[model samples]
Target: MQFLAALLLQADGTDLTRPDLTINYIIIGVLLVVAAVLSVIVVRRRMQERDDDWE
Candidate 1:
């Protein structure tokens, strides 16, 4: 039981402890920004095409 407690408290080779999540959050944020940019680009392209067709 004590060994299990220690394992949970300590970082092992397999991340047996509370893992640092700063990098994960940053990666997620970056991916979200990229997705937003891509979506905006797609919308702008479609709008430009539509405008050209209308005019």
Candidate 2:
């Protein structure tokens, strides 16, 4: 994957040089996944606490 990234960076045309927009899109996607995973963890913890309170 690192080799592919370097190879892609060296390749020609607008696809490689003007990649800021593409990078932003990829960053946003990664952030969204992180947020989703964190939300799942928070919800599971809350549910567990609620169950403990009921007991």
Candidate 3:
């Protein structure tokens, strides 16, 4: 029972430490940048296609 309680407490504790948090933030930032770039490319391509349709 005590072991189970201790295990539960440990599991409930925040997993993010200083370095881990920083790395996580960096990964998220990179992903956001990639997504933004991809979206821009897709939008530009779509716009170009629309323009071509008019011609």
Which candidate has the highest lDDT of all? Answer: 1
Scored by Cα lDDT, where does model 3 land? Answer: 0.89
| Sliding window of 10 residues with minimal summed lDDT for model 2 | 11-20
- Model 1, span 1-55: residue lDDT tens: 9999887767455654567999999999999999999999999999999999999
lDDT by candidate, in order shown: 0.90, 0.88, 0.89
Better of 1 and 3 by lDDT: 1
Q: Would you give me the overall lDDT of model 2?
A: 0.88
lDDT of 3 by residue, 8-52 (tens): 877887763435477888999999999999999999999999999
Q: Which ten-residue region of model 3 has the weakest summed lDDT?
A: 13-22
Point out the higher-scoring one by TM-score: 1 or 3.
3
lDDT, candidate 3, at 18: 38
Which consecutive 10 residues in model 1 have the weakest lDDT in total?
Answer: 9-18
The candidates, ranked best first by lDDT, are 1, 3, 2
TM-scores, each model vs. reference: 0.67, 0.64, 0.67
Q: Could you give me the TM-score of model 1 versus the true structure?
A: 0.67
Clashes of each: 0, 0, 0
RMSD in order of candidates = 5.4, 9.1, 3.6
Choose the strongest candidate by TM-score.
Answer: 3
